[model samples]
Target: MNTDIAATLPGATKTHRDESFPVASRLIAPAHRAVVLAFYRYVRAADDIADAPGLAPEEKLRRLHAFEAALDAADPAVPLARALAEADRRHGCGAAQARLMLDAFRQDAVKPRYAGFAELIDYCTRSADPAGRFLLALHREDEAAQGPADALCTALQILNHLQDLVKDRERIGRVYVPEPWMALAGGEEAFFAPGNGPARRRVLDAVLDRVDTLLDTAEALPRSLRSRRLAAESVATIATGRLLARRLRREDPVTGRVDLAKADFARAFARAAPALAHLGFTSDAAVCRRIVAGSGSSFRLGMASLKGERRRAIHAVYAFCRLIDDVADAAAPAPERRAAIEDWRREIDRLAGAPLTPVGRELQAATRAFGLDPAEFHLLLDGMAADAAERVRIADAAGLDLYCRQVAGAVGALSIRIFGATQAHAFALSLGRTLQLVNILRDVDEDAAIERVYVPLDRLLEAGIPDGPATCMVQDPRFAAVCRALADEAEAGFAEADRLLAGLDRRALKPAILMMEGYRIVLGHMMRRGFERRGPRPRPNRRDRLRLVTLALRGQP
Candidate 1:
């Protein structure tokens, strides 16, 4: 530890958390603040070493590697290194991420010239990308978000680079200004030289154009998430990036310095309150209400009978469920798909009043309203994750049962709890299982097309149908038999759930009954139309829906 005290002092001294520069910001839960800060301390210390002009290149290299070594250590002797290790162990962070920042710092000590925009972006990959990646890990965001977060972080890095161009050239003899752009604008000498004011400004303007595009690319990132705290902070960061880009446009970057004023953030923060409300789970239950209405016809119809807190709670659950299904069904690459599902799991792990995604934040509010248990919420995630796989195999009835519990049964139980029914646990589970099984039967063709085989492998084999999505399977007579069998199971489940619901209060239970009946009617039509063949998918016709409303009027008739 005492190998070179004076040389490493700056990095060590700068190790304390910076109040002005939030590692994760106030929007992050206090419980997780330490994980965020631990990363910051390690990265900040390494960053200080790279920025240290007093330290020689070899010395910087020596100390930085020492920091890197601390990654795999159980307990690093260096304070910053210890924090890095602690964050890794505590939050399940990998040493690999800490190594990424160290690599960037190493580049900073030696490599100063960026030949092109792409090369500069590659630098940003290692330099700025790591921070967003680790932050997402802290927020428990999925891999789907990492791309956009990386884009945002890279833009910010470029902005900082542009803002410090003059100082870097004058003191360090470094040039991060892309080489090709420098030539296109004026020339290296004219752009970097202090006297050639007009030419240098032109080069800076060209650089600003590139930064502006990056900022534009990152615009939708905040909307894609549901966390209020992260939303508020991300919007603020986006606001600052936009503000800085404007400054680069207005001020002569070659002569004047660009600094973010507190007023700029104040103005943006005020604007963000409304933007965040739309993007975050607001107090008004708007996130739940809006997503439920827009998501699916079936959900809207089922939830129509619910009102007041009960309705809001169900909508919140519906909204949350809808997001998980969408993540599983998204046509992204496999890694991204898995990340999307894991993000849900992580958010649920640390769920509180404020979460990163707006839907999650709303669910938190809904949970508070109905006293919803997170354990059941977790079951919903497990179900979604199962669907996210390319080809989910159900070996037998047992597998299908677990899948149903994961996807719908858990949600059903949560809904019953929300609806003020304490004793109808079996009913809720049965209903969810019933609905999910019906959905599987109804979507057999559609699910097969998506390479999904929800019907157990044994059942498919028994039915003499192939196990994958193919034309032969579609035309096979056995496939129809499989559909019939599944439909029968769903029908049995429907009768059971209906019988169980009768034991609960019939007053507060109207909405629940209507929803169950809605499914029952759909199941009836599917069976009538011969579900095994290329029959039309069942939709509740106007008359059918009206009948449901009429039944509701008769007090669970």
Candidate 2:
């Protein structure tokens, strides 16, 4: 098998162009990209047969069954199967495990809605769990490590289904709200009706409880991936998952869409980096598995480097942040995402102390120790949950201010507890708010291109411009004036950010300062470019980042 031929296989190219996988992300390792791309291509081909438009149901089923038959054969001739065989001969790709994906893809033809929890888990076993197992096999993770990876993958799949209920229903006419739950909520007839409040709430709450359990099981993956780099990735994945879960719980999924502001994502990643790095190097899969499965003992060991209770507290906060983020970004359709976010908002209102998980318990302890405001945490969660469902266009500077406060300012308040700010929280929050404003301005064109208009409708109306892209507004003198005004407001936020930095504890201020200064420089560049355009995105370059780092060392504000 020629490795290059196998790498750029025609089938792989078609699959890369498919929508089912994030095949071309910068996040994937270059070494693994080709194989993963091939695997995705195979899966996409199978999925397409089962889902292609205008195909009769019987025909779809027949094709899927035939595909499964090919997988069971000793010497399959199908493009994907042939490619897999070639990869197995050279790269040692796991033939048996790859076949498992084919088996799972076959389920789309016959099984749509699950009967119950056990049946759902069974589906996950084939569809979701196998992908993680295959990835582990590729990485040579042993049985011990495989266990937690399987659990996390299954959990993620379940969460994805729950999030995508609306879109799934619209696309396939299949509802994943289990039969039992639907029955309890007055059967499918009432459940499917729009604005079926009682039925929607009951079904959502039940699903959320189950998802919470799955997340608990999945949370062990980071501990299982004990190597520092792997642990960081695991933490990032788990944190993102947890964040989505939190959004689902707080928001009414029937109506809201959840999202994590870029700034919030940055802050959360920075906060989790220390604990993730502490996991160190380890090759024993059994030990890694034990760490993930055991809970408190493993968590304590993972955080042993921290002095006193702060270690546990920070861990809990990081975990909570991860959970909430995941909920915000669950793979659900926009409507379901919105509903989940609304539910999440309610959950935050009811939150008293962190729950019993190691990270949660730690966070609870920290809140008590630091006298943190519950409202601030609640507000942050509210903001995230709200973003999941709502997509309002910003009309003017006032609208932009509101957007920044909800997305960025809320995060700044939470960071204060972790980093300790005393009188600086307000200033830090202003900086955060400003950074968010800058983001909105920089991404104005990109956002509108995605059918997301962040420019306020009022400003558009006032400028005698039609409500649409910033480009249209730029052509109108009045609308361009509104754009400039919004930019000036962002500049004001930057000034406030500088003041916030002045009040920070220097030792604890490096990350926040670096991030703020980076945003400030970008804003300066934007101002110089004449805020008249909204199509191209403005971002800082590596050289600019390096310059910012140097400036940080000089203690220059």
Task: Note the Cα lDDT for every prediction shown.
Answer: 0.72, 0.58
Candidate 1, residues 1-557: lDDT per residue as tens digits? 33343335473534333322234666566787777777777777788787787778788788787667655553335666767787777777735677897898998888878766667888899988888788777677777667667878888888878887877777666778776657644677766666776656655665564565455445556665666667666777777787888888787666777777778767666646755565432232664575577666565655776778777778878877876776677543334456667867887765674465545666777788888889998888888777777666688889999999988889877887777886888887888888988888777777766577787888888777656654456568777888788889888988887678666886666666777888888888888888555566788899998898787667445
- Candidate 1 local accuracy as lDDT? 0.72
Compared with the true structure, model 1 gives a TM-score of 0.54
Residue-level lDDT of model 2, residues 1-557, one tens digit each, is 22222222223224353322223333445676567666665666666665554556676666665554454442345666566556556566646665666566566655667666566777778776776766666656566666567766776676667676666667766666667656655676666666786556656765665466455555555556544444555555555566666666666555654444456445545544754556532222222233334343212322332334544444554455555655554333345545555554554444464242333334455677867666766666665565554344555667667666766776666655655556677776787777777776776665553345666777677767787554454456565576677789888877766665665675555546666767777878887887655446566688886776575565433
Q: Which stretches of candidate 1 lie over 4 Å from their true place?
A: 1-284, 352-354, 466-471, 552-557
Worst 10 residues of 1 by lDDT: 13-22
Alpha-carbon error at 279 in model 2, in Å? Answer: 9.9
